[model samples]
Target: MCYYLKLKYFTLHGPLPGMPPQFLLGNLAQSGLLFDKASLPEAHIAFKQRYGDIYQFWISSTRLIVVNNLNDIQYIFTHRNIYDQGDIYVQKFSIVIPHGLISSKGAKYKRHAGLTLPLFRRGKIVSNFDLIVDCVDKLLIRWRAKSPQHLHLDIVQQSQNLLLAIFGLIGFDYDMETLDNDNDTNKNELTKALQYFLSNFNIMLFSPKILSTIYFKLSSQYRQSQKTIEQYFDRMIKQELDNGEELIAQRKRTSLIASLVGSLQQDEEMEINKSEEDRKGLSRNELLDEMRLFLLAGFETTSTALAWFIHLMSKHPQVQQNIKTELSNNNSQGLLSLDQLDSLVYLDCVIKEVFRFCPPINGTVRTLTVDDRLPETGAQLFRGDQILIPFHSLARDTRYWSIDPELFYPERFLGADKDHHPYALIPFGGGHRQCTGQDLARFELKVIAARLMQYVTFGDGGNQVNSGGHLSKLTIIPKHVGVTIDFDK
Candidate 1:
């Protein structure tokens, strides 16, 4: 099928099935369906029902293809050499995190991934197990201080505070006293900067480039916010370099920043041995960009996942009892070891279910490098055409899953969907460009869930407050995450 545009005299391939036109604004007015702060996932589902798995729409003059099939998504992600990160993401995120792995492409992305991958390896992450456990324990202590009369808690806010402390301790060697000393002005400033950047990120990403530029020029608050965030990153990067030099002198590499700095130095030495043309080390500004990306991505996704886990547990008391039973059976006690945490088999299933049910990211985008035909439909794709792999749609598609995808059943992993298609449940994406910190994220989730289950029970805070809807932004966040916490006697 093809769509002919009267104004441009151009031919476009594939189905064009959506709401009626708005003259010059072809789907731009209805852009709220896909890009709105709320109801993004629902809009995708509605579009899929009208059009097939693969459909085309216009965002102004640029054409966008939404690919919802598992096979197509797998093919695109696996062929990382053929396609690169979409221009939208590079253009939107580069201003804040220029050379970070998420925005960088080609050799730069490979270099950043190589330098940062080791820090998230199983052994390295498990080495920091005690630190993560201590953070969880501190959170639990705060909960213990609360009145035991089924106190209502905002899991979203609480989880954010807990993960910020963990990220501060592990990502950087600095202490963020947001969890303990609320009066700490430095920590408050840092937290506010991060929150401000994240809350407004989608606005910057979706607005037209010209409009955003003009707004930034006129809005002093936006400019000042960006300056504050950059200043904080600069100070943190300088501290990391100073500490990294001392650690290198002692021949000990502990933090992620130290490892990155050491790798950069090695690259410099190698470059000196070779010609100047072969230089590959990251510059100081590049290092700062990556550090900012790590801090933001690390804390935001994990904390959101934890909030969902807690909210789900509150509704499903049986799942909580099952996790507690698994903990008891595994003989967990006194700061559980990594092995003990891993042994909580039922809890693992529950975590997987939570990820499938409420993914942190809704989808990822890719820009075509050359003219190509989609393998499944044989549709023509031009160079520079943008493709979206809707993660939420694939995970919940009934065609790909054996059990009913709508139900919140953790047992599906143990039985019906044990050997499901790999791409059908990719919460962290796939192929070379997948999240580098997935191992660390999973370990943190398991440890926090286990620790929380050991000390307390979560109950639903009634339908009015606990009704689950998503607030779409940089991430798909739960609209309401209020829960009642009951301490274990």
Candidate 2:
């Protein structure tokens, strides 16, 4: 079948499918061996240029269309009915949790969202400022310690620490204190789960396409490991519910899980019950899946972003200096208000620009619910065909942003014509299923960036820092990035 003919027949508008696809592995192997390397970005860009934006692939009869146009992306994201996290890993993962915001579809998703959103209301986030501030202070302390030996910091790990602390504010009455943990209760389960996620993430990023289905089965070890983490999460949630006293009453102690389960189990007086079985809350399956989602979105995405920020800083000392100087005068003692953060014009510009160049989640996939025609080319997209949007490419595309898209230019995100396209800068994705953790991720990054700007004089870790590539799993990430921080004062 001719490529254009296929699109015409299917009533879809996309790049003509090129290359003869492999039977079992499909073009996924041509992009890179799925077993050891899933370099989709490299392939997406190359073929996107060769194939002209939207390219088609037959991955074992599952039609794949890769889209780079902003218009196509907007259409798919806006029409949520067809798109679900239908990835094999995600589908199996959902079988466990059944319906959390990440797993549920359609009506189930709506119900799950209703049950969870209240806990993250704007008011609640505002009230929790002190918790976030406290966590940043801890991160600063760790950065300060790096100066003595002039050590190389694994920012990936630091970013993880930062997020766990955020969850601590939302999870336990206590801080995770991951940086200084001596005990295993708060530290062990979370750490092990994340570590497992990190290791598994490598397998996904570099693994061959066949490993995805035939050779791949959820490991028994992964199942057992999931249980250990959930048992801990359930215990923590039970503590909060059983207390019956809101953390605000005696202390600030409320976990997201507790918040979730609390909303599920209602009461006469409306106080959430903290029962033992509820403490074991999630079914073994539920715990594993949620843990996977948490680690992927929670830590991996945010950490890679933070790592990129620091790496860019090391490369551009002057830019970092400008940020530090501005922050030094403006931090106004400690902890930035959201309003104050908004006002840090240059800092905000830098972060946005950094993401423009290096997005955390490189791309996302959405399936078409109904036949749709493209506004630009008047091409049609048929239902059930998967549209893979290479978000990073779109963000930095020369046609949209003009020449030299790879350069780190923070000003591009500022004033007048800044990232003009509504759907162009999608570090957190778009529409209903867009990442909810975006707020928390930004909050953590801003605080960490401000603190690092305050205390560290960044020096280039040189080529070793940038060459390791990303450990792509649920979230795309920079692999083995290391940096040197010279503490100020």
Candidate 3:
């Protein structure tokens, strides 16, 4: 049966090179992925080295074509209609946020994107700059209270707190109070529920894809977390409805949740006989999922990126000093305007390098819609086949960089490696399905980092704790981020 299945699925792609799979388990057991023995990103790097660019990876009977060539990646991302959303992407995210934009495609995706994308545009995000700074100040205050004697801190948790507070306010006009309330018991019930959901979801990353549905069904904690999350969304929706029309209209400018609620109400008022294709707004369940997606994606990716930035800064004091120099050179006084934030050129390079060095997402997957051939690699692909485009691999590949890709230097962006291929350093995946909240994420990160630079300098706690390694969750975050925070007088 295994041989027959292999002949049927794998052979049709024309004997693509990859590690031989174990019977029944496929490559899961041999790849050390099933038991958490290897990091998936590193494993992809190893496979690319061994198989040369394009290779096949199997999770049980499921097959994935992992591609490392820039041209192939560019072609796949650019031609979104042909590749759509990958099976793996839709499969994994659908389990968590089935109705959200990340898991959707075609007409449903058009509806969700139409309703929500405008709220995350650059103009709307820039308008909320002060709100972001205010949230960061609350975090700074919390950290200041732990000064001198207790300055050593795990930035993973600290970054999480800061981002949770920021997203809670800007995303929904709700305050998580994660910074003010340190004790888990004292956290808002919604915050606690979100924490619980994410913790369990992280565990799901290690488990096999086939077991995800069964695991969610059997896990009582998972069910309870879902219930609590739903309850929170219910209240938010009711509050939005109670505000009537005027408040919702005003909130559409600043609050993503308010905008979504307005869209939902619009859907309700749509003509009943209209075709599904003509419908634009989301249903209530979808509204809940979109809210959950905003909460989950908003905080999770930005927090992880901030943790990476902090970890990188602690290791490279020179880079930190450079950023400080840039800030001082600009005579940045008090909170910076959006134009002022954009003026910090060196700081911009450092942030870009942080993303390249360690993308929050390891890779993005895209599934083929019709039979096609890769433009550069000449690899034949079948309809419904999924491909993995590893961001870490692309960033680290020496072939694509004029400078040593292994080095953690930010200056490469300004000098010899300047004008690198556009697709070479995509922390956020590209093309039509690119991350909607990316503008907001980048703006928030710049504001927070800039604020931190003004008031404090991060020092390496020591080799034992500060030496960089990553922990893979929904996003990749530092495994150990103990660092000393010295307050500037």
Candidate 4:
């Protein structure tokens, strides 16, 4: 009788409210997540509507608190000590890139972030404006060749290639050759490996953890892709290490590889006598993992954002025209200078609106470290409890917006919503654990959007083809992004 009472008291359901779990399946059967009745973002909105902001969602047997209100989001995001990286976020990435910053925690994360984050700061990224413009021009050149016919282009693949090219040159000093006229995606080992990993990674995300682990070890295809990726990274790392001393001597050290190699060498010398816990530099394996993570991070999010930007432009030609008007007024002929890029204030508003409307990331997760109650909702949270901060829900909340939250009005940012709550429109998230490469991501989006405005006008590909829906992957990308690309020049 005592044992039964204890079991009843410590039930996994706790006090939060959600749909009753169906044996081991939890709410998966009713969640509409399995059958594709609605996209993940749409499901989140539906959940918010059904169960108010601070409610519970069960994934398998695990219970997660879904917090959509801005006050609760502010509290959770601000309190990093109380709410660290959630297990879901850490577990999935740890399986793939164990030593990467995304999987790391506490001191190790600090060391990794410390060495790498500075490389992506505004000062360094702004200096690479011309390089970014050159990459955008490569995409323009390719599209120009295809402009003879009124092609209904799916810009996702092209955007990915363009981003890959930019990240290769700007981040690693290597040309991905993605934008090359003769380049083939199927034959490219690195490209193929990345694609294979992401596809499997998505599968693993939905599978039971033990099953995912077993699949990883047993699958020959996964092993081959892993080997190919490791070999590519190994060659790159070795080349960087070999050139490190020469580059340092020449006082011309640039690129992420050079900086990372330099830091590694410095750490090796400085921390040779230090204990493992006290050591500051990343190990060789850590470097390898970081390389993989950086490649994905550098290209994936920005490319996804670009895809959304194009989709939005196709739907709203007036907004595109406004951007073009701003560009022309600034006389941004040829490649724009840093001053010229900044001078297009209306263009900046459009980019901000794009981020607000369809944030590339649907949500960010945080796990509570101690027992607490939400100040606004008065919901009790346990130490091990996880919370989903839905970016889409927060942005679309009617209480926070002066204009209708459903409307995609860039002018809102210039008017009543200009002084909008900072936490409400956090596409990159907020607080200490916010995305480190946010500055670079924003700059890349702005520059690319500005360049596209100068060169092309995207027209609606019609409702049958152009109707926008979310496809949730590593990022939330457009499900159907067919746009008619008309070159302004």
Q: Pick the candidate with the highest TM-score.
A: 3
* Candidate number that wins on lDDT, 1 or 2: 1
Q: Which residue runs of candidate 1 sit more than 4 Å off their true CA positions?
A: 1-38, 57-62, 150-153, 181-187, 243-246, 249-252, 263-277
**lDDT rank order:** 3, 4, 1, 2
Instruction: Give the alpha-carbon lDDT of every model.
Output: 0.75, 0.62, 0.82, 0.80
lDDT of 3: 0.82
Q: Which pairs of residues have clashing backbones in candidate 3?
A: 86-367
Report the C-alpha lDDT of model 4 over 345-404, residue by residue, as the tens digit: 998899899899999987888888899989898898889888888888889899999899
Question: Please, what are the lDDT tens digits per residue for candidate 2 over residues 268-356?
Answer: 23322443222322333433344345545555666778878877887788888788777657763344566665567888888887777
TM-score of each: 0.89, 0.81, 0.94, 0.93
Angstrom error at residue 416, model 2: 6.0
Instruction: Show the lowest summed lDDT stretch of 10 residues, model 2.
Output: 268-277
For residue 150, model 4's alpha carbon misses the true position, in angstroms, by 3.0
Model 3 C-alpha lDDT per residue in residues 232-259, reported as the tens digit of each score: 8899889989998998899888778888
TM-score: which is higher, 1 or 3?
3
Off by over 4 Å in 4: 1-12, 23-25, 182-187, 244-246, 249-253, 265-276
lDDT of 1 at 183: 46
Worst ten-residue run, lDDT, model 3?
265-274
With a 3 Å backbone cut-off (N, CA, C), the pairs that clash in candidate 4 are: none
